[model samples]
Target: MSFNITDEEVKKLEDVASQVRRDILRMVHGCGSGHPGGALGCTDLLVALYFKEMTHNPEFSMDGKDEDLFFLSNGHISAVLYSTLARAGYFPVPELATHRKINSRLQGHPATEEGLPGIRMASGSLGQGLSVAAGAAQTKKLNGDDKFVYVLMGDGEQQEGQIWEAAMYAPHNKVDNLIGFVDYNNAQIDGSTDEVLNLLDLGAKYKAFGWHVITCEKGNDMKTVLETIQEAKAASKQGTPVMVLLKTEMGHPIDFMVGTHKWHGQAPNDEQLASALGQVKETLGDY
Candidate 1:
């Protein structure tokens, strides 16, 4: 797909993102538990991908041939992924109300056993998604598909030793068809990522690992996100893998939830939900 998007298209995508943020707040509030901070922070990038960037078929398939594929590495924020998938026509939008419910397809983390339309694998463990994405990308290469594989990982997940192993393997094997992201929100459940485990100069680390690195300081902004992703896609398949260091605010537009790690896995109460819903306009109507 072409990366050049019109201003009108950006406005439409912004509308979809607003509705998605509203969906995240409602789903977490309905369940009384979830990771809202990162979900809300990552809304723009997900919206841009499903709505405007990715060449995916919401018709849903496990093989994922002839299309760009995305995997959520930090699956704690399943709220954003579910909402984005539903809004993108992968499933009924009303299914979002069942998030984290008993036996619901929209579980706390993405699961393959549920046979959910968009989910290809179960993903909640911290450091495994990059490996899965690398394997999928390699398969595409071996099959001569020429499509791209994408994955999103949390900055806190960088603390895991397995992440470095995948980092080394992908570049050394010339997995140039893969594009990965690290959500550099800097906050985790215990505290700031720096306090828990300082991932000093993540971009430099990736560069040293023989990967092309792109930095997007304003990950929450729709326009900047589109441009950065376009740049990343253009950089793909050039004999080196690409990584985007996405800098984002934890709670994003909501005031009370922003600026701290406390909201990492905390759900909004009735009043907080109302306040958050009030902040994000319900452009496409609630699910």
Candidate 2:
């Protein structure tokens, strides 16, 4: 099934993406440390989900009744996620400026201690979110709620033994309501995923684990991202979980940062941030 996204909506998504990029920079710069590469790479996907696809009301609590649930397995990218959520009305966008600062609800990694409206679980330890998402999916099933549980994980995170354990369990338990996404950007904090821990033939691996694997070669492309997610949603009907390997360029659209592992947890200095922000227009007024 083909899904059509209007030009106006595309413009809106681009606007949101720009604001998210700004927020990421400001958030990281404010704290003096954080992950910006994965955050930037995943910006468009978060914008697409919150602005278009997901059935969510940011004003509502995290109980998620009549709404979709999102879990960020790559929790280090909290800047992008928090910005997207705020822009989507999950909370005041101004709060993003306090990200990673001491006593702020937006921690270096997301935590439920603050009881933030959009965040459901504490993450950042890695390899645990899939299990958390699986548990949420099961809860939704038990409650007779037909909402979807979405999760995003990094490609390097695939090396975690727990991810494979979750992969093996989800399908066997018939967790069809869950959809997992891998930000297959190749680069990790240390180096390329291939260099650190190769995840060759990831699609085949997901298939082997009983998931219907889909690939999105352009994770930064708004239209392709939306279409691929729509297709995955359409294809989830046979009691098997779905996984999409999204190939993204870390720090995409920035000449200096793209395709490098150095940007994974580094913050751009004043000049670099200015240069990066100049490349992405502020379509939506910066908060």
Candidate 3:
């Protein structure tokens, strides 16, 4: 099922996002380790996708023949994906408590070994998701499945050489059914993406690779994100892959963590968690 964007639905998604943010902080704090910055930054995009945009089934499948598929290339942000999947009904929400715990399906990085319901693949390795997504998109084309394939990558991941290779491959093969997004929050584990490795004119780079490119300057704004996604969907299926550069803030909405790399992979302390939780209302009930 896909979400139709209405005023109420947008508010519903915003509520879900608030809950997901709570989940992210709690999961990381529970484990004493996990990436929170990128996860928080991308919550709105994933919430928008599973709750409002993509035609997907929470009833799990490996082959994903008929429904749209999504891959999390920047797999370190597993908190957001796990929380989103659980909130979306692929699994129970309370399982979030087992996050990063041994033998739990909700590992730190998504893994297929446990046969997690919403996870399509294990993807902690940087810059590999787009390649997998391109292949999946081509598979759907060969099978005549009209559903689209979606992938989310980190802007820091753009530094990986494999990303450039896949970037070139998708357009050359005309994988228009695949839509990719880069969480361009400008911050990474070490520091800012510009401080680490500058991805100069990322949208232009994607366009030069022959893909249709879109930009969302306010990725944290749910309405803007939903509208930008709508625009991306309209541009898809023409002949080339689509890429959306979502300009988001790392550790968004959390005052202490916003716009910095300090929280990229750090968990909040008891006091910090308390403060962070205080910021987002416990919408949809916390796990």
What TM-score number comes out for model 3? 0.98
TM-score of each: 0.98, 0.98, 0.98
* lDDT, ranked from best to worst: 1, 3, 2
Candidate 3 lDDT by residue in tens digits, 11-78: 99999999999999999999999999999999999999999888888999898879989999999999
| Model 2 RMSD in angstroms | 1.0
Candidate 2 residue spans exceeding 4 A from truth: none
RMSD of each: 1.4, 1.0, 2.0
Q: Per model, how many backbone clashes are there?
A: 0, 0, 0
Global local distance difference test of model 1: 0.94
Q: Distance from true position, residue 183, model 1, in Å? A: 0.5
Return model 1's CA RMSD, one decimal: 1.4
Candidate 2, residues 1-287, lDDT tens digits: the string is: 76878888887788889888888887887778999999999999999998998888888676797678899998999999999988888788888878888788898899889877799899999899899999999998899889888999999999999999999999999999999999999998789989998999999999998999999999999888999889888877579999999999999877788968999999999899889888888866787
Residue pairs with clashing backbones, model 2: none
| lDDT scores of the candidates, listed in order | 0.94, 0.89, 0.93
